[model samples]
Target: MTKAQIGLIGLGTMGSNLALNIAEKGHAVAVYNRTASKTGAFFENAADLRERIVPCATLAEFVAQIRPPRPVVLMVQAGKAVDEQIAALREHLEAGDMIIDAGNANFRDTIRRFGELEGSGLTFVGMGVSGGEEGARHGPSIMVGGAQEAWRQIEPILTDIAARFQGEPCAAWLGEGGAGHFVKTIHNGIEYADMQMIAEIYGLLRDGAGLSAGEMATIFQRWNSGPLESYLVEITAEVLRASDGATGGPLVDAILDRAGQKGTGRWAAVEAQLMGIPATTIETAVAARSLSAERDLRLKAQGAYADALPTGRLVADEAFIRDLEHALLAAKLAAYAQGFAVMEEASTEFRWDLPLGTVARIWRAGCIIRSQFLSEIAAAYDQAREPAHLLLMPAFVDTMTMASPALRRVVARGVEAGLPVPALAAALTWFDAFRQGRGTANLIQGQRDFFGAHGFERVDAQGDHHGAWSK
Candidate 1:
């Protein structure tokens, strides 16, 4: 009897779809689930995949079905469940076999796991599989990071199953030891920032410009045809256009304003702070989500200030609308600049030789943040091993020069109108700070030295000296 090509553990939506996707590619799959019923149900519903899959009743049976140096993917929940599964699988697997973890795991946890299996003769892989349920069923952008030997063995299979961009696979070996997941986490962070900016724009249009949901949908649709074309923008158009079947109104109008998040975005922000990288856009995005969660508090606060708030509205003419679009594009570029900067900092700090260009290429498709703008990013990194800064790139500099005026105007209008535009405002501020040759930080350093004798570096001299302000 011949052995299956690979094995998959867990039969949840992602796991099951991935299994079927593999099987559909004409590869034999051995699948198992913690609950045997899920395995049974998977096979029952997926009749087309029946012939290609080897359903295993137990963990030992699953491991036994694969060939030597076998690769088994674990799609279990992140954290403790991952540890438990690894421990259980280790008892039955042979030396030199590979374990692929295809879950949204914290990168630090992945590094620890890789360390644990270093001398055990088993290869451990932490892969970031993005594109959600549909992408898993068809093709996802697969970010592989772990043992190099293990990656070489599984690269063919991974590349075959990933989404394609202009005939290129969206799968790539990012780096060693958790680099894939780290990139994915940062990807989510950028996503959070992108979304918050979009939401803020929606608020600006609705409250400031008095555009209805349908009108906003049309605007988003138009934006999707321009440089802002992206999965998020496309989806925003669909979301805005959707109707509440029962209420006969736009679906977005009925939905709650609160936004929920998993931990990836927060982790990205926290990691940035730890590394001393300024990821203000991502941080503001996380802050926006937290603020949104305080719905009742916001309502009470709004009521308290309702009487004193100024009544101001933005112009809804074509000139103003065009300005809003330019502002959004500029802010979005700033957000990406901050996100990739964090990646660059982490790559240096962690000693991971991350290919920033490849990261941009893989993200072009089969990711939540897929956009037309990413190709420009890929081009920028491709031109220079590492550009001094994304904004300094000629294309981005031109965009900023043209669009920043609008961003400034929009932000100013939001402030005067009592609308919170944290992400957008943060993006503009970051851009401004980045372009500043001489920042107000000299005052900050002086104050720090005065208060705590921390010391400050001089522009003219080499030594760090403390300032005595009292004298």
Candidate 2:
């Protein structure tokens, strides 16, 4: 039999779907699973595609099934499982073979893994695969980070399997080391902020504007045709429109308020804080998710403050609803700006020389946060000179100028209505701070200097200086 072109070593939903995708694309793939039984099950499910799938019972057999100078994809759980799989593969594989980690790994861990595999005669690729289960089965946005040579070897297959925006594939070698994973982390962070802002708008519409799920679903579906057009918004409409088979009510109404996260959002916030960058929107979203998990405490607190809750209902008029849409767009722009800023800082700090424009281009399709706005971001970066910050770009400047008032009004209304709008509020505050020429940090500097002799920068002078104070 002809040797498989690539090998996969997991049979979970993502792994199986990805394997099928590869096989369907005319690349013969060898597949394996830790449990062994899953390998058989996956092969059976492949059915027509089984002709191109080689299911192996053991690690050595799986490795042997692939052609020499192999590129094997590791779809196992991140962290220890990844390390274990690499170690096991190392024992069976020879020089010139490659191992690709297609999990949502911490970039630091990806960098460390690179260090571990150094001089081992094996190449390692840190790849970020986004777009959930369906994307994996069809096409996903593939972010690859490693040696250019390794990328060259796998680019054809990756590009073939990636989603396209206007016929351009959504896959690229972003940079070396953990660049792909770092970009993915920032992507998820933006996704968190985006989802939180959408949920906040939903809360305002439901409670303050007295809109039912179906009514809100109609509004969201309409918004999806405008500036806020995105996969998240599209799905929000679908989710709201869904009816619960159990109760015959809107499916969204039956769901728990608590949201779950898998750490990438927090990682994005933590990395931003470490880098001294203000990712307040992402941080606020993370905090909101944590607060959501405190269900019992929230219940008690709600009861204790029931009478104090604001009862003012918003005017559900055409003009006010348009403001809500504009507000969401403005806040969404802020979140993307912060995410891109984080990536820009990471690129410089890591010496990755990340192609920011390419990043935006790849994100225009196949990812959870895919949207029309990303195309504008790509165009903004494609200019003769890239803007220092996303919001500084002329196109974005015009957008913010036109939409910020609506954002301010929505935030003020939400606050007065006693609805939680943390993410939206954070975005507005961050945008305000970003555009301000002078901030109140001077007072903080003076207080620090007086209290701890930390000193402060003098605007009139070149160097830091101490302030005279009576202690």
Candidate 2 displacement at residue 298 in angstroms: 0.6
Task: Indicate the residue-level lDDT of 156 in model 2.
Answer: 89
Q: Report the C-alpha displacement of residue 389, candidate 2, in angstroms.
A: 0.4
Tens digits of per-residue lDDT, candidate 2, 1-471, equal: 799999998899999999999999999999999998999988988889999999999998998899999999999998899999898899999989999999999999999999999999999999999998988999999999999999999998999889899999999999999999999999999999999999999999998988999999999999999999999999999999999999999999999999999999999999999998899999999999999999999999999999999999998799999999999999999999999898889898999999989999999888999998998898888882744799999899999999999999999999999999999999999999998999999999999999999999888999889987998
The numbered model that scores best in lDDT is 2
Q: Per-model C-alpha lDDT, please?
A: 0.91, 0.94
Off by over 4 Å in 1: 385-387
The residue-level lDDT of candidate 1 at 172 comes to 93
lDDT of 1 by residue, 1-471 (tens): 478999999899899999989999888989999999889889888887788889899998999899888999999999999999999999998898999999999999999999998899899999999999988989999898976777889988888889989989999998899999999999999999999999999999999889999999999999999988999999999999999998999999899999999899999999999999899999999999998999999999999998988799887889888978998999999989988888888888888878888999999888889999899999988898454678888888898999999999999989999888999999989888888999998999998888888899999999988876894
Off by over 4 Å in 2: 384-387
Pairs that clash in candidate 2: none
